[model samples]
Target chain A: MKIREVTLSTTPNAEAVADLRLGDIIYLDGLIYTAREGVYMRALEQKANIPMELPSQSAANFHCSPAAVIREDGSFDLGAVTATASFRFAKWLPEWMAKTGARLIIGKGGMSSKDYNEYFVPNGAVYLSTVGYGTGALLGRGVETVEAVHWHEELGIAQAMWVIRARRMGPFIVASNLQGECLFERENAKISENLDRVYEGTKPAVLKRYGETDDRSDEVIG
Target chain B: MISLDLIQTTAETLMDKAAIEIPQDYLDGLRAAAATEDGDLSSFVLQAMLENYEAAKEDRRAMCGDTGVPRWFVKMGNDARVEGGFVALEAALRRATANATTGVPLRPNRVHPLWRTDHNNNVGIGAPEIEYGFEPEGEWMDLITVHKGGLFGTDYRMLFPSDGIEGIKRFYLDSLVAFGKRGLACQPAIIGIGLGGSKDTCMVLGKRASVLRTVGSRNSDPKIAAMEDEFKELGNSIGMGAMGFVGKNMVIDCNIEVGYCHTGGMQMSVHAFCLSSRRAVARIFPDGRVEHRTDPNWFTDYQRRETIEWDPAREAAE
Candidate 1:
């Protein structure tokens, strides 16, 4: 698999993301903004404001709710911040991407694999699936700082928008890429084919045990 | 009578432990999975999970940000006495969960679904749900806590009699495949299958199987054990890998729990728990002896112990 490094900035280099492919590995560094289902929906309705000045199709956004605590000393104690499923906001993602100018979407499970071509490819965006349970590792070494930007009270500590600085924050799989390829769909189809082959191989034996002839048309005849 | 303070403290400690410590069975299962991974991505992902466990434990942090809903399975003794009674016990648990929001520092997961209102402390009406089981003879109360991701990667379904065994198999495979396509999003899940009960009972059993049962433990009934074995192998064969990359093992294990149905229809449910199966059990005796148990054993007759050494350096070398 190909590997690429991404750095989120106000003027993100679009060329750096143009050659991204499905199943490639990405190590994201630099600045990132956090958002979840609420932020996207609220932003689309024009009710909420995105605090960061993100460049179109060059910014990396994490779909997460963080367990962050502000200490009495004024420093932030970052807790486990996990990915909310991408497809949960399926209908709004295309618009969110277009409006927010987010180029890289980091989440778990790929965004509705069925519509990757429609939602991601045209926008020069990609969906990367992070290691689901690696929250501790990410919070420990990846993230350097986190500051609440907007919706801190309404969205709680986790689902709120936060500006963060990260260092090698990810080694995510490119579930969907700019080339319109989707790793999640490809992998599922392969597994389904193998499962079908197993079912077919076991059908005759199961039928024989029930004292039924393996004529292959019992259900069809019925 | 058990003091209310004891109950509150126990609940707080248990939630904190559950959030920080990745259960031994979970770590063991992941180590075994890493050892057998056929693809580089799977191995890398599995190893990262192990490292996440160490990092959480060392840093005193929540293992997964989605510390999940606070679910308590309370086994109460028939003759046990409490200072505040059941009402007080429930209240204490609720307070304990909200308090742990900072101690275990659980993510504030409780929210008003429609308006997106934050409750801040994970406490709400019918929140921190307690499933009580009364034992006729016992002097101690056992509280088993499971922090399950309530929103993401949860599934339930009902089947008509016509659906039959073939239908059950199809449902199991179809869900796993769908979840797999989503990538280890919930990949390498410990699947809990509940067959032949009302929808609610089936969901309860499914949750118990996934969160309580030890990773490699089996159902005592021969049929269910065989079914578990078959599905475990079949799930791994799908090769959804560690994080849904192409690999040998999609599931760490499968646990199937069953109950007699009404003979009219079957309510089969599957609870998918991500590799981070976070849970902790605490037992409080009448004599004031408090013991913490890592093995949940919600269905099995006896508790079994499996010591797992999640050595990141060793795994990295492998």
Candidate 2:
């Protein structure tokens, strides 16, 4: 519930982020790297070195594709920046968290509980989910500079590795914390239970509303 | 005759408007949802989203980082004459897309899938995809462009005739549960359900429902409209909240579009659009009068929802 401001480097320990609880908003200040499917897949395949020295503690890799216009002077206009979903990167989360020392992986759409329990919880990391539509808010964090360290040509500006200096950059929720607790999963569990009960309670009303009474077995619902 | 230059100019205007402005209907829907939302945090999140939208307008920047793939729905006049014909119309849109990548300052999202080549511009093979609906007698073109951002999760299923209505509802609920987690798929989601069609038709219909249709619209068939109402109530009961938290509202609306399928089997596609729900539409008359609209009115016959309260004990007794 409280806003916690934390500074992260590319070499801090994951224990720095372990105590952050789910749903707590945090403002991240430091060097945060950006990557997506291509860079991460290529890194795993070639065993190539990642682009930045990320903080081991609050080491965050945002699944973002920034709408940045690089000026002739090599400065970025820093237009829109939003999180890409993490579902596609499901299988690689464990390796990504371990290898990159990314104790905090920020993106939308929660990751699988398996990945959370196996990798994030045990590794002292958390998966934070921010609003994917909050491009202006994300850009409001004050991006000082952008340096593309790797994979620019392959993935273009959107999917390449860009080391960015962000000041008070994030207002993201701890979607899944280090203790294997996930806010999304917990909420979904409640919803799922509610769904069953609601379905049972509402089926007759629904059928009647659609004019598909039990006696009229041949009538299609829609 | 509509000149190629006009087409090009109109396309440019459409792209910019679509990128820069969140439609009035969508804004109104968000405000209503926020006001009605019972969850404290979720309501705050909705308000914050509204603020984010205003910020986007003030900054003249994209509302979201992902501009998404552009989905164009064009309804052309039957007797309309064009200087360069249909091909020219498509080319103009493509050029507009390319220019808008930097002009609207859209993030270059279209890429060569196989070679992993970034186009720099959003135009590429099958990029900025367009769908056409022609009128028998008219002199204007109604163009509606919707952004298919990343937050809308994709779904498709093949069902035997046996699957029926219960099966369809089950598939929909399951998909919602899977994609609507952690605000990942983005909630107060607007779902588009396409049923009883070929695979592609179902998919397109689903996408149309998700993006093209207005939030408060419904199907003409009373049965289908009733189904929409039920899904909306059931989806809200799940309590996915604003950003996948525990709350009262999950989906603000559900639009179902159905097509007749062969006797053997049926294909269904479910597409979910996030709360942003970005779209803009422009219509050009014969005399060269261009009217831009926030609502495309994709659903021709929109039936309003009846006011009703949830009754648990009545259902429990039944």
Find the candidate with the highest TM-score and give its number: 1
Query: Where is model 2 chain B poorest over a 10-residue stretch in terms of lDDT?
Result: B301-310
lDDT of 1 by residue, A79-161 (tens): 77667776666777778878877777888777654567786777777787777555554554577777445777565676778
Shift of residue B214 alpha carbon in model 1, Å: 1.3
TM-score of chain B of each: 0.90, 0.90
Candidate 2 vs. true structure, TM-score: 0.84
**Residue A192 displacement (Å), model 2:** 2.7
TM-score of chain A of each: 0.78, 0.77
Best by lDDT: 1
Which residue runs does candidate 2 get wrong by more than 4 Å?
A1-16, A49-51, A56-58, A69-75, A90-99, A121-123, A132-141, A147-149, A201-222, B150-152, B160-164, B264-266, B299-318
**Which regions of candidate 1 fall more than 4 Å away from where they truly are?**
A1-11, A56-58, A70-75, A112-116, A133-136, A201-222, B152-154, B160-163, B300-318
Tens digits of per-residue lDDT, candidate 1, B66-90, equal 7888789888777788877889999
Range of the 10 consecutive residues with the lowest summed lDDT in candidate 2 chain A:
A213-222
Clashes of 2: 8
At residue B211, what lDDT does model 1 achieve? 82
Candidate 2, B137-178: lDDT as tens digits: 677888787776753457887776666677677677656756
Candidate 1, after superposition: displacement of residue B272 in Å?
1.1
